[model samples]
Target: MDGQREREGRAPRRWRHGPPRWNRWGDEEPRPRWPWPSTVLVTAFVLFGSNLAAHAQETERAGLDPFARALLFMTGAALLWRQRYPVPVVFGTALTTLVYLGAGYPYGPVFVAVAVACFSAVVAGHRGAAWAATGTLWAGHALVAHWLYRWLPPPGGPAASWGQELVIATWAVAIVALSELARARRERWARERAERADAARRRADEERLRIARELHDVLAHSVSVINVQAGVGLALLDTDPEQARAALSTIKDQSKEALGEVRQVLDTLRTPGDAPRAPAPGLDRLPELVEQAASAGLTVEVEGKPPHLSPGTGLAAFRIVQEALTNVVRHSGSRHARVRLGRDGDTPRLRVDDDGPATGAEAGGGGNGLAGMRERAAALGGTIEAGPRPDGGFRVLAALPLDAKPATHVKEDDR
Candidate 1:
């Protein structure tokens, strides 16, 4: 289910900030309840305000008949559905306003409904519909006021002046312009919110992969050592009691170290922003890895000096070496492995090889070890190559850049 949501471009419910809020842009936000209070208030204002406007312009224009008052009320009431059905509401309001004007009812707050409807339509991403409705209303009004006024009510009323038409045109243009500006801002804000969610998800996925790699390295190496020591203890229990005691002791230490590392990784999940309780293991702990490998019955020969490395690179290098040796002990028939550490200019080069005719015990079961190593290297702008050597042995080679910083957020793929 979570995978489905991810594939469908939705974050998991657990990661959501809260229930979705209202969005005019159709972003899966819940539909708001009909705007009762605001719509009712506006409708009341338009109805009463039209009466006031009619009283003021009484001598020069037609009086407000029952039909004129009904048109005003209907235009305002149409606002109730503006957000839900913006295009229809806008067109409906525009039509009612045009009819009221054509009947020669004195102009008043009747245009308020048209303005609100247009605003809602544009913000709802129906820009074309909003613009069309506003344009149609204005053109209709111009025709009635100029060319058709001779046959309409208020006998002998003069044709509307060009100045009046200009004012109305300017008002319509201002309404559309303001609505368009609001639409642009709404879209920009939505885009920004989506970007923030994507970044957060990327960071989360990177952290999860990091923890997975850490746990794999720690458990694979330690458990392999423990398994070997347990076997040795069982085999020598009667023949060499003292040797068996030493093997049991190694098992205890390896298990304890594995538990500590696992706990450290878990701690990050629990108290995410807190610093680690212990410093991460690095190349300086090479001797410890050698000792652990020896306990697992693998003779590890280390040549050349360990290169200086940043904490992250050092930890990665240490794990690469650790995983390589674990693979040898678990899969290779050869009891001996060689680790060569050196530098290629500013980059560090690490190679681990075991003489083998192929024991092929499914190295680390399902072969995540090598893939994990490659991911770690790739994250730091480095490379990993692991395969059968030309001379019939298994080899793992790593080249890591010195200037590469710690991967605070690793990409799944370089993009």
Candidate 2:
């Protein structure tokens, strides 16, 4: 978990500030959302051209009113900055439209600018502000239309009434509703992405746990055996020539086998297409393991026939004994230890107890090895109990279910 936090903290510093200047040669910042400045420039030309056409058409009936035409042009130009300050832009455009309407200028281009402002506000995550601005603009439009038509009523001006107000309200609501929908979709995508990342992290943690267990089990058992054989070979070299040669040969053989098994377990990290090495040592190697430990200095007591266990169960049993013996050698300060491997009904039981110095000083306590043992037992749907015995020694007892399915098992069967 600590490693995970460190990785997460470092990931953002690399991404948020963008690539450094040296890496900028081939990389580019994300393009803008609608080429906003270009859009504004093109919109200005179109609106100004339309307003000019309207002014020319009306010259004969009411003469070209340069003042109102100029106001309409300015209002259209003001819309160019709507994205930066949506509410203010909408308000300014609405006021200019009011002035133009009051002065008998055209309405088409003013309506377009008002619509653009409403959409921009909604898109900016300001739903309340958008509604307020839309309401103000709608009121201004109604007031201006009423006043303008009072003097020179259109053919259907009286019928227009408050119905025009309803139309403006509907348009504003549609713009806000569409923007809200888009925002909701974006939020959903973000949540799903977060969930996926969390799941991936959890899977990675589980994998690390599995690897740690494998390393502990393999290294602990093999190293302990090698240590015992090497000690026996050195101790008997001059006193017993025949025994010394046998002990040295045992050391060599054990060392080679340990190296091979360690390499096999490590090869699991390779690509799937790669060939697997030899299988891991399991209960089948228990006698040889007990012999190695016995040679070191411990008196291992054995009883009952070793069961024909599945690969996973065998490895679990082997590791339980290995860790227990390692603890005895390292912390027990005990010259003699006893290992009991047998079956209790359907469960395979492994018990390793040492008649060592049980005082607080000698009982150095189980660290990660203890945690690793518990994890292994729990993963096998079994349980382990380890503590200082009342008689003045440390005892480790693990009972693993032989029938536990291979898929649910933690440690891999491969060596």
lDDT of each: 0.88, 0.67
What tens-digit string does per-residue lDDT give for candidate 2 at 1-415? 6567677785334455344432112333242233457456646764676567676746422333667557766776776677666778777876776666555554455566666666666665566776776677677667656664556423234423577678767876776677678766765765676678778887777767777787776666656666666667788888988887887777687678777777876787786446667666687887876776765566677666677878877887887777777666656567677777677887888888888774333222334677777777887788888887898888888988877743343332210
Q: TM-scores of all models? A: 0.88, 0.65
RMSD (CA, Å), each prediction: 5.6, 8.3
Q: How does candidate 1 fare on TM-score?
A: 0.88
Top lDDT model: 1
lDDT of 1 by residue, 300-365 (tens): 999999999988888899999999998888888999999999998888999999997567665335
Q: Lowest summed-lDDT stretch of 10 residues in model 2?
A: 406-415
